[model samples]
Target chain A: MALIGILGGMGPLATVDFMEQIIRLTGAARDQEHLPMLVANLPHTPDRSAAIIDGGADPLPALLEGIDLLNRNGVGVIAVPCNSAHHWYAQMRAHSAAPLLHIGEVCAAAIAPQVTRAAVLATRGALSAGFYQAALVARGIEPVLPDREPQECVSACIAAVKADRPGAAATHLSDVLDALSAQRIDAAVLGCTELPIAARELARPAFALVDSTLELARETVRYALARGWNRPV
Target chain B: MALIGILGGMGPLATVDFMEQIIRLTGAARDQEHLPMLVANLPHTPDRSAAIIDGGADPLPALLEGIDLLNRNGVGVIAVPCNSAHHWYAQMRAHSAAPLLHIGEVCAAAIAPQVTRAAVLATRGALSAGFYQAALVARGIEPVLPDREPQECVSACIAAVKADRPGAAATHLSDVLDALSAQRIDAAVLGCTELPIAARELARPAFALVDSTLELARETVRYALARGWNRPV
Candidate 1:
């Protein structure tokens, strides 16, 4: 099996969520049957939004450092769980020698066929940065956004997740979803990892919701299995 | 604060262990004080030992793939918890744009002042590959090893860890430590992450031990704080 390396900790809960998904998707009968992994959860990273908006610390150096560590350790493939961090994917790809599985790309590919015009409910930074819009556009899907007031609510929802307040985030996100529904958006893409937990709680099946995290996990499972890492016991 | 990216899962437990240490060391209060991270825990890596001993699949490609992911994400520094994987550090470093933190180097640096001659009790692959010896020598420290019989015991201890048999691994490691004591080595380096858990259980105070996992954690905290990622509340 190939050694999987994770560069994580956009939010601690998101990292845990991703790990749980990996384990559940592996379908291991026993603990030993699970594949080996190398993870560097550096939670000390500066805020992604702060880096983008406030012109503070750039996170690219630290992110590259993590890649070096994985490369040095001989990890087979790498994935990052942070949705907003994908904004720098092009630069990171240019500097890296290893193959990186694109979570945003994977998520876009999965949801493209299912939804025609999906509302992207993410952080103001993510929306402003055009991270998801570009990827969705490439897939020929039109991405929608919440109205001005709900956009603030969506930002608050993202902040609530950063504060580890999933319940509060869900409430805020519920409002945003309602606003998106008012706009007649067909589906909502939970563009942030923390947003999914709240989206799951709201349980509004009135409109299809695309969870980037779950999609990333599904793609990761397929990637691992296709490479024979999920050998049968 | 700089972003710290982790490329991990040489073993899942080891990755968890490292993350726990980072949290403990950070002394974080609010969630914001914690580091922001991006993780991709890939467990599809081929066995490091098989690659070294039996000439199995090379992990370099996979390792690079992981590095690229982190680099693209903009991590400032990267760390991996596996000692055996460090054998490929030089090659990985050459391909990496970010600075990779060296667990072995961190361990060697931490133990250098305390001991002149240290006995290494590690996996057969680690011992056979001469990674520890080479690292210690580079740091101007002399590394001692157990005889073939005791070395076999150490290998058994490592196997017990991979099998998740902490008790058996502890017992075997105790025997190896006893053998090392007879040779009058200054201290024993629990060069493997799993071995530290076992060594702590055995708890032979008479033999000073260098735990690479614990040391790496300490270094990570220091690195984070030094870089201003974590601030006192």
Candidate 2:
């Protein structure tokens, strides 16, 4: 299988979450059977949401530097776990020599046939950026979002997760999902990578859940397995 | 802070655990304020325990390759999470340009001043190889081991964790720790990196517990912080 490059540390916890998911999804009995990965957990990279939606400093140069490091270390495929960062996906893909996997597209595909209308719980930046909603629309699925009041609640929950306060985030995230359920949404997409950290407490909510991190992990394993199959027998 | 290199995927979950600990230990409020890390989660590297204590294929060459990759990517210090792998620490340290963090030494020091007689729960390879035990002994701490029956139980628990069966591993690990408590051991060292996954379930046993992975993470953070202080301010 090809070496996987992870462009991570958007909030730190989410990066570890993504790596753990990738490890769990792989069907390896021993260490030598699992895929090789190079991870640049550069927590020093400027915030993606702040840069794209808040008119904050651009994170592209740091992203490019991470990609360059991954490339130098021999990663063949790159994946960014941050949903808000998809706003810069095109630019990152253009600058990267390795193929960049789209977390939003993968999540959209997984939820497309399962639900007609889905709500997304994400950073305010991801909500404003529209990559997730755009991907869902492309798949013929309607995306639902919370009202302004509940949207702020969603943002607070995301912030709590980023700050490593899973207990507080769980309560706020539950409220955001409850608000979406009141709108008759069919499923909920966990667009922010950090949201999955509260997944156990979420209890599947009142609707089906589409976890972007899990989808990305499954996509990564599929990519690695395909490469392994194509290699000389 | 300096770029920390992690030579990981000795068991993929342990790598994630170590990374999570590092993230938690660092004092950062934002993404850009955390430490920078380059990790080679090369699960494809041959089994360290199988190579060292079992007279199986050597893992040194693969270990060297990972270190070389980290070096090329500009890592300032290297840390390996696997306890059994420390049998090769001297050789790995010799082959790399970056200073290697000895997980056993770090754990031993943290445990030495706290307990006189500490039991170790680890892989059969680590128990036989003696690096962790030797480190503890060197610091004037007496090391205790479970009899063959409970020792095999400890090995089974480690294997279960590596295989991703946390529920089963937790049950077995609890049993092993119970046996040590019955022997009146003062403390316990989680010598294998994977053992910490069941740590919460063990409830600190009848004595204090030293997590080698947590120690390594603390050491990694100290290394990065020290480097930051030394840089031109």
Interface alpha-carbon RMSD, every candidate: 5.9, 2.7
lDDT of 1 by residue, A135-225 (tens): 8888888988777899889878877765667688889988887777766666788888878867778767678888888888787777777
Tens digit per residue, CA lDDT, model 1, B1-233: 55666666566556656665675566564345776554545445566766887787777786777787778767777777778778788877777787888888888778756577888877677777897887788877788988899988887876676556778988998888777877766777888776786776875657688889889888877876787776422
Off by over 4 Å in 2: A112-114, A229-233, B112-114, B229-233
Lowest summed-lDDT stretch of 10 residues in model 2 chain A?
A224-233
Best prediction by DockQ: 2
Per residue, candidate 2 scores C-alpha lDDT tens digits across A97-153 of: 899999999988888476888888887888888988888888877888888988887
B120 in model 1: Cα distance from truth in Å? 32
Cα TM-score per model: 0.56, 0.95
The TM-score obtained for chain B by all candidates, in the order given, is 0.90, 0.95
- Complex DockQ per candidate: 0.14, 0.64
Off by over 4 Å in 1: A112-114, A230-233, B1-32, B35-229
- The superposed Cα distance between candidate 2 and the true structure at residue A117, in angstroms, equals 1.6
lDDT of 2 by residue, B1-233 (tens): 46889999888889999999988888665566677888888777777777766789878888888888888777899999998888888889998999999988899888747578889878887878888778878987888988998888788888788888888889888888777878767788999998898776656666888899999999998888877822212
